[model samples]
Target: MATDDEDKVLLAVCDVIKGSTLLKAGRSGKPHFRQFKLSNDLSRLMWESAKKMDAAVLISQITEIKTGQVTPVFLKNPIPQCEAVSFSLLYSDRSLDIVCKDKKEFDTWTTALKALIVDKYDNKEAVSAKLVEMRGSIVSEDRLEVQLGTIKTKVLLKDNSCDLYLWGGGDRGRLGHKDDKPRFLPNVVESLLGQNVTMIACGGSHTIALNSKGQVFSWGAGPQGCLGHGNLRDRYSPLMIDGPLRDVNVVHVACYENHSAVISEDGNLYTWGKAGPFLGYMDDSVTKQTKPRLVDALYGTRIVQVACGRSHTLVIDEEGRVYSFGINKFGELGQGHDKAITKPTMVPNLVSICKVSCGRHHSAAIDEDGVLFMWGWGARGQLGQGEPKSLFSPTPVNGFNDQPLEDVSCGYGHTAAITANGVAYCWGDNASSQCGVPSSVYGELSSPRGIVLPSGIRPTQINCGANFTVLVTSIGQLFTWGCNMSGQLGNGEAKKTFSQPMPVESLSEKRVKMVACGEDHIGCLVGHGWVPDEEVKSCMACKKSFTAIRRRHHCRQCGGIFCGSCSTKRYPLLDKGHADPVRVCDKCYVSLSSSSNIK
Candidate 1:
């Protein structure tokens, strides 16, 4: 008969492994007296239970026989001759016995014991029931990562390769890489590694990038000190600007010409960049600030958003208060006075402002009650007010009779918006067919016109570039319209312009995460192509034109451009070259011949 400890192992291991292996002994006595062997370490109580409880009576009343010569009836394996085993007695805490066991038997017993403990301790349903109770609690230590823009279709192409489409690469530092170079293909931008970015916006040559952390990074032309770096120096990399910004986290940022504005988490407004009399409170001492300055006039009240025009700013507060400031030369401020405001000033009777967007020379806003408002230069009906020319203050654009607005975006001289369900509409100058309205359908639209999309295309997000419009679909497709010069559409070719949205070719696989547009350049974040490889290419940092010409025989050392006669030393790194159409001067050729072999 097996001891109590051996009985437990057989109970657990036999059930778990399901008879894969076994331990049995030949009986030597009628009582099946097989010499019991326990592991080197067994609970004293267990051994004592077996020894003192009439299972075995010993001279010392020892519970377990330690290093003892127990006569073996049946041994699982050859027992170790010298190892000691601790023993305990039943109903006693002070006495113990030693019994020896084989090393293999010891290991098997240990495994079985652990399985038995787990079976005894775990209650499956009880754990599941407790987890369900915690699900209702809302306080989460982790925050949700949200983004605003959709991916561009032409951001990546087939074969897992990159083709960066870069234009306006000269000025705003928009390329985010080396300047003084024109990048024709959409190349990989390696600076955003490990960063979770949500939105990107560009104004002329300046750019503003917002990450999930609520921190804003900007670069590009800063002459108007539009970069907010506090100084006028141009920035090549995205750098954070210091300000009074905090928990009232920033959600959206916009820049126009040389000015920038941002909407905070709490809906307060902040403006910086060129400040003129039209901003209100006109005074020589306080007009302009290169850094961000809070619009204290609307501080206490929550303002939903702000938009910037070429020289003016428009803000709509939570209670539907429309505020206008800055250059009103075209009467875009809409204060009804035809004068610019140097500080925040309320626009007379504006109410229920749901959304507001600005163009190069005009401003448009929609009320919560679904009424469209227009002011300033309405040239070619960008104001959707039926007539061209200026409207000094807030005037309702006739046609929306009673339709509510969901969102809005402004272009250089036009505007576009989407309804709650997915219908897109546009008004304003369709000069490059950016409005998606047929070119033959001329003149300004006094009312909103529907944009016809391809049969199955539904836009997830929409963006307006200088004179173009980009639409991103929920299924990761990108379609673009308007001026395609410089291949801004990423279709591998440039067109004078397109009248309707056209699908970008070959990209249905790469997942584009985000896109940003400058005056003539486009930036996008693409996935899955950062693998490493080695290839010899021209250095972006050096002048390629200077190294194009070669010398047949020049000193390999010092790069003196002298013949072999003058070169005493041979340096192969700089000396190796090809002999092309023209023969190199003997003096220059001989200079490179010394020490280095002509290849």
Candidate 2:
């Protein structure tokens, strides 16, 4: 994966603008070390760049940093009014600019900005060493402790008196619980006690995690060996995936279908999963593996980000080139045809993809400008294409052509996105109300449409399940709608699905930072105000479904009338009042009964 010399390097470098000296440097090619430093004033650079480009003045201001606190520094002069002003930042470059009204404003901000600079420089040595160590390790688990995605895993940390929240499905622990007994609430995993965990991911059934120490651990299903454990056994607990990948620190990890990918501090990519061409699984005969292996094909490419679909994988190189591989059954891989690739193939016509998400059958990418592009399955409107016909290549979603999309996520048959201003929109099949908006359209939409939430609530993140939707707000509130079967919606009922978003009462007062959805179960990561009790929330419908219970541990799955904790106290299913009652798992309950539909 050697790129031409012209390819620009990308790395996440914190750019600090303070007083006289604005310094920027990050892990370059070698071991973690400060390789580049810039001493010029950011304000002067901004004005010069704007003037040279024939652009109007656009004042740029940032709060001053004093004693590790951010303080606003107001300018005596007003900001320049211009037709357009743009701001851009690259991971490695750290160069910045602002074209604004006058020198007075710049000077005033500069004075305030100076104090922050001195503070940053004073702290640079310690932070730099930490950054280098991060850049050197192959899988930096510490950075992942508190990640967010569609499905979230929460393990309580008694030491910190807080719960560790992780999102994204990297393993079968899709419920986001440390274990898999159909957890409905975020609880302490016990196994992860004492150690501070920040993030977790599930791919297919496999799970990967990062700790406060910057280490990565993985477990669960290893189909195609996505667990990176170097074995195919279903790990009931978390285990470290591998050692330092190279002289790099892993900053992010993404899981799709059965493949896993990670981004390092220096913007390098390392992946392990299906043995395909682009995935670098050299064992031509072995399609899957049980351990994490380096993707030699991507060496030196400086990958900034990655994503996975059900059977395909995506990598965004620093130079904005997208590489794709794996199954292209529906042309979801974006490789120009339904040709399955064994190696990494450059995705056609995709550049500056700031974010990417893959559904069960399709894929979506958001560019740097916030315009969303979708491809793959259009059936049930998962692609938002306004038609049932599937797409073989990337197509721009029309409704947001003018407005920039802040983020986008896809489900089995739907898609949702948030705009830059915080408006959430959805399109495609509303069956089970997964779309969050009412759409009689049975299939997909060619344009994006808005999804209404309870008024005055703007969601910061969203996740989609088989036929349901979950939203978490900046204020730590949780809302859900759509298919409520099995109490997945956590409303203490087995009612029909909703066509619009509704708050989940059981999780009220629980500041939910993340949410994860399984095919039927759901899990959320709580922040502040969540009750720690494990009281059973009964689903009256489930109660009626139960006919008998032969074993202990709640029989919600078996339609048993007793809660798990109460199952042992009952005389099984022998009661005369329950004569001829039937027993089955919770999943079977959906098949045995029908209830009145609630709007």
Alpha-carbon lDDT, every model: 0.54, 0.53
Best by lDDT: 1
Q: Per the 3 Å backbone cut-off, how many clashing residue pairs does candidate 1 have?
A: 41
- Candidate 1 lDDT over 1-599, as tens digits, reads 64655445544343222211111212332111112322212221122122345232322233332222233422322222212221122223332222212223333443443433333323334323433544453122221122212311111011211222233344646665545344544544334332335566677777776754466777778778778778777776667666655344687787777688777876777777765643333455654667876777667777777777788888877788888888788888888766667778888878878778777878888777666777888776777766666788878765433455565666776767666566777777787787887656754464567788988776656667777777766676766777777567666666577878777653455555555566666665444333222211222122122223421232221112322233333221210111111223333334333312211
Q: Which stretches of candidate 1 lie over 4 Å from their true place?
A: 1-170, 180-188, 243-249, 266-268, 277-282, 286-288, 398-403, 438-447, 505-507, 510-517, 523-599
The TM-scores of all predictions, comma-separated, are: 0.57, 0.59
TM value for model 2: 0.59
Error of 1 at 111 (Å): 46
For model 2, residues 1-599, the per-residue Cα lDDT tens digits are: 42431111111111222111111111221111011122222232232121245312211333322221111111112111210111222222232322211122233333333433332223344335544655544231221122123322221122212244333232355433445554433343433432235555545465565543345666666556777767666676666666545234467777755677777766766777766654655347666755556666777677777776777777788777778877788888886688788677788999888888777878888888887888887876667665666888898886754778877777777788888777787776676767765445433444567777676887888777666778888787877777776556766566677777778765576567666554465545554222232342442223423235522233322322333433322211111111122343343333222110100
Over 4 Å off, model 2? 1-162, 165-179, 193-196, 243-248, 274-285, 437-447, 492-495, 516-525, 528-599
